[model samples]
Target: MKNKQWMSVLLGLTLGGFNFAAEAQTRPNIIFLMTDDQSIHSMGCYGNGDVQTPNLDRLATDGMIFDRHYATTAICMGSRATVMTGLLEYRSGTNFMHGHMQKSTWQKSYPVLLRQAGYRTAFAGKFGFDIQEVPGTKTLPVPSHDFDVWKGGEGQTSYSTKKNESMKEYADEYPHCTLSYGAFGRDFIKESAQTGQPFCLSISFKAPHLPRNADNRFNKLYKDKIFTKPDNFGRENGLHFAKQSHKTRGYNAFEDRDYDKDYNRVIAQYYRQVYGVDVAVGMIRDALKEAGIDQNTVILYTSDNGYFCGAHGFGLKALPYEEASRVPMIIYDPRHSNSGKGLRSATLTGNVDIAPTLLDLAGCSIPEGLDGRSMLSVYEKPTATIHESLPLINVWGVSASHALTVVTKDHKYINWSYAGENYEVTEELYDLNRDSLELVNMAQHPEAKETLKKMQKLYDGHVAHWGQQAVDYNSYQQFGMLFDRTKTWAEKEPFVVELDRASHQSVK
Candidate 1:
């Protein structure tokens, strides 16, 4: 199987006629640490005074911090798919709630690319996406034989190793899953160092996600703390879709219990889980240092998607709001002496850029047909703009809550489609420069009509460029029960493609 995989990789390289054999030897080791459902507001480095993230703050101090990073799709599976394949969720065909990542797409992912380039690759912690399991269909195991080391679990893995009955060997000294994953990471780092090969380790932690469980050691950290609600915590000034969600989704943080009690308890537990992830980060960093490769290794820390801690009266993610889409990203390269340490870059970047950036840094030939460009230049030129605008999509199956949002540095425009019909749309416009909290929707404002037109044109262009052929929404509707709220995915209409860019000119 390994030989066959290598043959396919060689064939691909030969067909493309690109080689990086010479540059591969000097490439720096890569460590990508990702947390589940962690927002920038939850991190100390990003100026959240309530949460304690000493390790992540130190990581930012050692490297560059990206202030305007976002996820193309603000959901776990879709965002993870984007980071892995460098493609939009619609293009990758992995946008559904439950399905395996197609093998062809998986082959082009960073792990496979780095492994084929003579770098040892390892993946630990939660492998976010799940494989489709039809009775007669063949499927690969959770961490599918692609890496030299694979210590991961499917779906939302347990917080405690004792609950994870299947994998005992990978368990750490403590029963916590974060520590267990960290143990795997440390072992892989040591192995890579002993072998004298450049390594790429991807750690995806399942912390601060749903069912927010924290270790007992951190139970007292925020027990007496009074968590403040977001300024837009209730239905006030929120979009209609968000307000409707609050009415229909009873399990959401806003609807589950008393707002004050639930918010404080959940927020505390969420912070505790984040603290656990921080401890894991410290462990991985110490392992890198102990292996004597800390300086040569590049450490990247980010999240799959941002979670709302009672922002806009929303508890979970999957919205195009800033709290749901904006994530924390840090790139630490110890060898970058040209710039001073601890630089903060406000360039607009997203999860899709991760694949291309890692491949570019490793001197590998990035594949064609990727939606994102390498952000390596942004690190060199902090003032440069990687993207003028970014598209945020939330089309999960046949969901009526689907939205298409176009975001620039200064503004955000959203077009919400009801029942998968493009014609039945509700628009929202926010000048981020003036209303950073998105308290005011300027879509109906007479003075903002021109801005709304420009944003719509941009959204139309993105749809034409990245949209896929019509998919059978009914076929995937069977998996709707796997999602959080049934109402969000109950609408069974097929997606409507936007008008052609050539025919639909911008409204000047």
Candidate 2:
């Protein structure tokens, strides 16, 4: 482990994706594909018995499957910010009701840094958040100018290809936005290949999201098919969860109303949308091969955040639970020696690690003040560990469900500070190794006393770091006081966000 750490640092200083090159390293083309509201359960590689995702499964087989990867901030807007900036949500200062990501932060993002360092960079599909010159100012602009090819849309991009402004060209052919994004990647790869330049392409797919408008081509594909429910599927499994965690749409699955009424049918429709992404994944890989850059191109697939899919009796996401924050992550670097080794890494990783890893593959220096470290070392050796701990945050939505949680490779600790008339300051501890479904809460168990104390110390360290590094503007500075476990509910209640940023909205 010590040797791996030393060598990874050496590679960070010197080599690109190709491992330990004594001379100059060949920079590989990077393609990052991310989906909306995808869970680890959606893929066949993750041991789902019902779903059919051959392309994603093949990518995992061709390279490595990350079993413990997570989105540090488990929401679309917030997680996307963390993925791009290599920073935590508080430091990035980006979310729906949170604030805008500073232009300076966007400048340090992987695409910007890679382009500056002589790599062609392209971005398409849901751009997620707009950039401002500062955190608090209202002057926001789409960062299309930052990338070489910008086919990105703002604000939860439409699933219909014709609806998205930059993607209308493909609507006549693809119709659906999921396949249009794939075509964009194919075109970019073909163009970049002809230029003989290493390129970084990111395609964020708006598939498998809510409101159930999956591609018609894939409609009824999963019809009459009953999906397998996770072990922690019903309300009985969620009784031990904190009461504060169940105040919003996140708890809708337990009510058996609307989308949650028919778990089999609704879950099947979600899988059908994921099936659209699977076909798109196949398209990108086929294009790479046709362009003859397949051997030198690296591909990574993950999600902004995970869907609940009725896990822990929760229908939607944004909770600090396994099915919500623990997303699907796969990295295939064909230029590296470790490629095609059929590896599964249990090392803990997070959304912030994506930028650093991509920059490292491009042979660009990672900027300072980043909370993420490159996961290429873990990619090289499946047993290696890059991140020992990461914070899972949810400061959006109703205040009752907003909480701060910390997770390690083996255990997780969550703190819900919204204590009042109906809720108390709650704590949850789970030995994730033994209870991957989060079916058991060891917070107050007698045998978990020693483990709980160690996790509490880790939790404290995160809170301290949040205090020191959280953005001072846009009400983010208050979460530090709000998340403090030692602070009383009365003392910290005033620190919460003041505005009701769509608290009345049905979905977060």
In terms of lDDT, the best-performing candidate is: 2
Question: Model 1, stretches more than 4 Å misplaced?
Answer: 1-25, 131-138, 165-167, 170-172, 237-252, 257-259, 338-340, 419-424, 468-508
Q: Each model's C-alpha lDDT? A: 0.74, 0.86
The per-residue C-alpha lDDT of model 1 at residue 371 equals 82
Worst 10 residues of 1 by lDDT: 499-508
Please, what are the lDDT tens digits per residue for candidate 1 over residues 121-219?
A: 888777877533431145567755888887777767788786665446755576778777777788888888887668899999888787767878788
Q: Model 2: how large is the Cα RMSD against the reference?
A: 6.2
lDDT of 2 by residue, 38-60 (tens): 98998999999799999999999
Runs in model 2 with CA error above 4 Å?
1-25, 253-260, 497-508
Cα TM-score of candidate 2:
0.92
Q: After TM-score superposition, what is the CA distance of residue 296 in candidate 1 from its true location, in Å? A: 0.6
List CA RMSD, all candidates.
8.2, 6.2
lDDT of candidate 1 at residue 111, scale 0 to 100: 92
lDDT value for model 1: 0.74
